[model samples]
Target: PWLPLEDDRVRRLVEARGPKEWPKLAVAFNETLDEKDQRTSKHIRDRWTNHLDPNVNRDPFTVAEIEIIRGAQRRMPNEWTKIAALLPGRTDTQVTNFWTNTIKKLARRALK
Candidate 1:
């Protein structure tokens, strides 16, 4: 995780140079930070793509999305990444967390 300042810098860098330049951006970005706080290019890229990108939708999941997730889980079972691919602007972590925190709890209650 990054401090707000670091995250701001990353967003600025991506806006200026775009996401494809992550390796080069990571090198430049890391030079401004202490060694203990350095992040890999892939890590930075994943963070930007999955969480920090302006395009990510942070809205509550819709009913259709919930049904899609339920269906996807029935077919894929634990395939969070694959399920996430079916929903635009969503990440594997988000999908897994929703299932673990919400849908799974509901299913367990139904069985009881």
Candidate 2:
């Protein structure tokens, strides 16, 4: 689902399905947006943030990064495929890639 910028096929899929699938796309897009909103809201509500990483960068990962991992383990919602479908701008593949890459990165950092 990771639509690379170079990929024209997704554009075609969008063009072909966009108008017809507007409502469903909007639902998916909104779900993704909702998760994003949750990410922001959680950041505001979470007071124990520094308990994990005092110097956590205020990037997309800072809070969401950790929560995603925790969510994966806790299985509060659905599997990552469902989560991937709901991430704001990231495609399923992108989410998979983020998990694949960042999880390793965090693990490596933790080992030290």
Q: Of the candidates shown, which would achieve the greatest lDDT relative to the real structure? A: 1
Every candidate's lDDT: 0.88, 0.44
* Count of residue pairs whose backbone atoms collide, per candidate: 0, 1
TM per candidate comes to: 0.77, 0.37
* Candidate 2 lDDT score relative to the true structure: 0.44
List candidate 1 stretches off by more than 4 Å.
107-112
Tell me the tens digit of each residue's lDDT in model 1 across 1-112.
Answer: 5789878888988988988978999998899779989989988898897779887777888999999999999998999999999999888888888889896788889999
Candidate 2's C-alpha runs over 4 A off are 1-62, 65-69, 76-78, 110-112
Candidate of highest TM-score: 1
Cα lDDT over the full model 1: 0.88
Clashing residue pairs, backbone N/CA/C < 3 A, model 1: none
Q: Report the lDDT tens digits of candidate 2 across residue range 8-98.
A: 3224434556424434434433353455432222321122122222333333544665576567636743366677544454444445556
Clashes of 2: 1
